[model samples]
Target: MKQDIHAIEVHNLTVSYDGKPVLWDIDFNLDSGQIIGIIGPNGSGKTTSLKAIMGLLKPASGFVKIFGKSLDEVRDRVAYVPQRESVDWDFPASVLDVVLMGRSKSQNLFRRANKTDIGIALQSIEKVGLTEFKNRQISQLSGGQQQRVFIARALAQQADLYLMDEPFVGVDAATESAILELLREMKSNGKTVLIIHHDLQTVSDYFDYLVLLNTRLIAKGTPPEVLTRENLSNAYGGQLTLLSKIVDLIRQNEFPVREKGFDL
Candidate 1:
């Protein structure tokens, strides 16, 4: 069987801060048109991997390719939604203003938004269910609404691949569901989305593919294949409490048990 070109590929990616390694020899390939989740314990270099892929951070070594090409070759075909905390909510920009910025790269940054750009921004806002708040200042919106605004911005980019960092971190259940629905719609439309997610419980439900990492690539595959007890133990170390929860999830969902000789 022939293989499709991966939406994103990272090979031997090593990143470090001040000589202390954050990610070490990470490698993975993500297929197009799937919702993929990157999950790991805190400080496991999930966000660092995303930055490297986006070219925000220079890898200490190795390379990343998008659509089988260098990032610069397909930069316009990619979009990114950063962590909410990384943004300045008080920048005095309306939701529409922010979303319209998504088009800045395609358009001359100094030029005004054209009718087509505004139309696309409006549609993106509607897709995120934030049409009513489009004119509101981002600072005035709640956490979930703010997150939706960023998603709308990313949608406005109209990219083939999206990299999101912890989009569901502080949202309510309803907002989470709404975002997930929108993500599924994106996937159905053939857009590949990779999200840095921390919630292990929702991993199986939210992602068609999962990449479990801890300073290195632990495993990458369909959720059933990557969320094994041994893999979880390897990624999370001695976090027995988390392991207990994983065991319960495995029992309840009947996921394949791939390893033996250790109590789950």
Candidate 2:
């Protein structure tokens, strides 16, 4: 498929926490209407990259652009759905109340939530299969429900670019499949999704493009091209020796044992 027009551009992006570089000299282009994944081991700066791109954390140097303009200049065109654990789930709030927060950003900071906003919030909640539990307190919902609720809020914004931080963490297999399908639908509808995915086994099936990051860009390309031995070695800190050995061993086996009832 042809790449969509560029929607997000990062130039020499760098971020530091407590004066220690967490992300360094990162650069990439994200097109409109593509589902991309950011993957690496824990603490690989995946979330940090998303935060920096969304302007939640300022880059120590360099800058990010949205639609050829500075992030600050086009804030409305971008949206962020942070990890569920990032918020106080136990905080007093209903499903409807939480979804409404997405629209609140555009209203006067102190204005009371309005009827139109409430309608939009309810619509978003329904979109994520949470309508039946709209009145339930947020804490009462399961992990998957919470993730869907947040994704619904992002949909409400109708943003051109979305940065989701681990939207699948703690979700069940069914919910994971649901979320992936939703992302595919978003791409078809001309929206961009950049997700921080943890499951390497599912990476190729989930994303078209990937940024295999490890405190830096290990590789950035289509899934097959980027997930090769060389890129895996770099991203995994030169630990591909074991993976290579496994592949070689598997290839050399004369009659690979296909488990009973699982013939390949």
Candidate 3:
């Protein structure tokens, strides 16, 4: 079998803040029409990896290739939905208004958003099942709705590849399902979507490929291959031991003052 000509490629992708590293040497190839997941604990560099690929934050010593070209060289062919927390939700913009920004890259800088752009924005909003709220202020929507809006914006970009960061952070089941369904549709249409995912329990069902990361790339392969116990342990830095303790406590309601009551 041959490796697909990757839609996105990263090699020796190390990014740091000051002298401290955020992303260590990471290498992966993302092929078109796949729903790939990036999963790791907080501070495990999942989001940082996505940002490096999007060219939002420059890698301290590595390169990112989009469609086999530099990020800038193939920017319009790639779309990014940054982590929702990265933006101010209070900004003055309606849902449709924000989605229109996706088309800006294709328009003359001095030109105003046109009727055709409005149609495309509306189409994207509809795809995300947010058509009725197109005129609603973005800040007015729930967390999930805001997330869907971002996905809609990416859809409006009509890019061949999409890089999304932690999209399911606070989304409701319906909205999460809706967003995922749309992504599947995009894949069926030959678009590649790389999402930063947090829920390990759902990883098997959610993505076709997995990029398990810590400060470095722990593993990369189909979920069943890369998400093994050893790789997951490496990604969690053995914190799974402590994390499991907390989860068991939560499930048992074993508060500091309470007896240990276990769940079946």
Candidate 4:
């Protein structure tokens, strides 16, 4: 397989919420067929970056290109698993029902799933070791199981590029191991996977490529190259206090006073 070209690219991307900047001039090109992790402190736009790439959130400026094309041009080739906490598991949907939703991308609007779609959904559930719970309601499963169901759904889509946000946030050790194994399998099958991860200890073990972000593009490269102490300190240090102060001001419809120009 050709590995010379980029699978995803972001150029000067910036995003904001209610006049509060979240991502700042982000730029990166990710190669295909690897487990890539994006990590940073909370409120560092980790989720926001993935959302921008998947077109779930619009960029205030700049652009995102999937396989050298706009999201609209390559939507079918991409699959996304958002942060589990962002989803309402209590919604009335069964395990199989949620997994089958992945097939919606392969069909036209208002269309029903055919037999083949059902087969694919079943296969995905089995791959994630959730076949026994396929018929169970989503809310009835544990946090790990719920995350696996979402992964199975993304798998059923059969997309070449997968973007996942914090799939390991609330899972048990066994579940985390299982998900990482599945990600490795996907990489072996020539798929590109990008995940938003938080744990600093497992960074080197789980991902071959790492993108460090703290509301901006801090560094991007192999874990060995980007996971240095200096980078980590810069990305995470003073973030909590800064975030709290900014949020407090935003709630009051105001921003911190600064000199002519200052970087947040």
Cα lDDT, all candidates: 0.88, 0.81, 0.83, 0.89
| Top-TM-score candidate index | 4
The better candidate by TM-score, 1 or 4, is 4
Q: Who is ahead in TM-score, 3 or 4?
A: 4
Model 1 regions lying over 4 Å from their true place: 1-3, 239-264
> Order of all candidates by lDDT, from best down to worst?
4, 1, 3, 2
Question: Which prediction has the highest lDDT against the true structure?
Answer: 4
The Cα RMSD in angstroms, rounded to one decimal, for candidate 1 relative to the true structure is: 9.4
- TM-score, candidate 3, is 0.87
Candidate 4 residue lDDT tens string, 184-264: 999999999999999999999999999999877778999999988888877987644665567557547755323234322
Report the candidate with higher lDDT, 2 versus 3.
Answer: 3
Tens digit per residue, CA lDDT, model 1, 1-264: 114789998988877665555777788988899999999989889999999999999986789999999988898899999999998899989999999989878438678889999999999999999989889999999999999999999999999999999999899999999999999999999999999999999999999999998876889999999999999988887554564455456556655333234211
lDDT of 2 by residue, 227-250 (tens): 998888777765644544543454
- RMSD (CA, Å), each prediction: 9.4, 12.3, 10.7, 3.7
Determine which window of 10 residues in candidate 2 has minimal summed lDDT.
Answer: 255-264
User: Which residue pairs clash in candidate 3?
Assistant: none
